[model samples]
Target: MMKMWRVGLDEAGRGPCLGPLVVGLCAVPINDVALLVEAGVKDSKDLSIKKRRELVDWYKQQMDSREWKYVVNICSPQRIDAALSKDGLNILEVDLFAECLNSLSQQLSENVSILADACDVNPQRFTDRIIARIRNWPWQQSEMDSIHKADSIDPVVGMSSIFAKVTRDEMIEEISQQVGFSVGSGYPSDPNTQKILGRLVTSPLPHSELRWSWATIKNKWMEKYETPPPIRNESINVQKTLF
Candidate 1:
């Protein structure tokens, strides 16, 4: 009997003011989807850190047995800034999603049904764009489905989300150790991140991982360097797209 596969892709750190954006892909046999469900797999956000770590360890074991396949694409802060300056976040995500999918497709020989947590407002459009980007796509009877909040609804996508979240979290921890200070979650809303953001234009860290194009960084640069700041009535376009 031939095998059929389900490929799920998701991302983490898209909205952070610091750190890299990570996209993850997980491919499992269609008949084995229930195995993941029975093993308590769900959205990463709903699982505690310890739970996520436990599940990741289990996933590694499964991979060792060739029961599944996975991969991740890390988009550095510099790469993200360049994307924003060129195409934009949506295009960047499309590329990253395709990159991850292609990595897994190279190893698998069966038809795949791709499920992605949509990053674009129009889920169908997102689905179409991804299909168009893939190389030698539609292998056998392959197909793709992109839906909003797929992580919460589809166990496969949820697994992918967990992989992405855990990878990004580890990277953030490494960055903290390197800087000798905790940067928090690297989101602007994070108090620790906000407190450290003021130093971007002043005592800039030797680490070049900071997203220089973010509005948070731009505002800090202007606040520290601009003289006689414009009045509130003046028009200012410091805000950058957050994807």
Candidate 2:
């Protein structure tokens, strides 16, 4: 007994120093998923900004005609901070997935299958949590399953990833302006990100935005910087992949 519908879920912007973590779940009719795949849908990270934007426009037009259902939730940095304070990142992410699935359960179809890209180290646990959240719905077992790379593997999830990434990146760029800094890629690895952080740890300017607990931010700030910009790595392509 196979359900007739297929759902796609993916998230974006999990590694930014600013903005939010966007978790999106979209249901693409089984018949339309292949069409989206043919229309150039792939993992959001693998697509160019211009191409992703164009694909989004095309996807929206098609969705409107066919009546697709998708939900995008932006979990702001503030929300992450609050959740981290309450229950570590792993549990917090589990909770967020539950929230998303709960929303989808309300609009589920009889022949539904869900695809979600793995966000945590343990994909099984993530899937179990989501399944548990919707256990009371009496939906078939095919209703949901979490994949390690659902976005790139499934066209519908890929489309959601593209939207989530573009939207989150825009918000991060806006934050960069307000803070008056280059703001690296929001991830802690880049030297530019460390530069902003090193100065903060030295000068100590009430860094509510920085994730002080992260090892990268914490360890880098401990180092003594010899240059102003801190010698950026030309190889790093945060600008290209994300924004």
Q: Highest TM-score: give the candidate number.
A: 1
Position 69, candidate 2: lDDT: 70
Backbone atom clashes (below 3 Å) for every candidate: 0, 4
Off by over 4 Å in 1: 203-207, 227-243
Per-candidate TM equals 0.89, 0.77
Clash pairs of candidate 2? 3-111, 4-111, 5-111, 17-186
Query: Residue by residue across 51-141, what tens digits does model 2's lDDT show?
Result: 9889877867876677677666667555666665566776656666666666766666456777778777788877887667664654665
Q: What does candidate 2 score on TM? A: 0.77
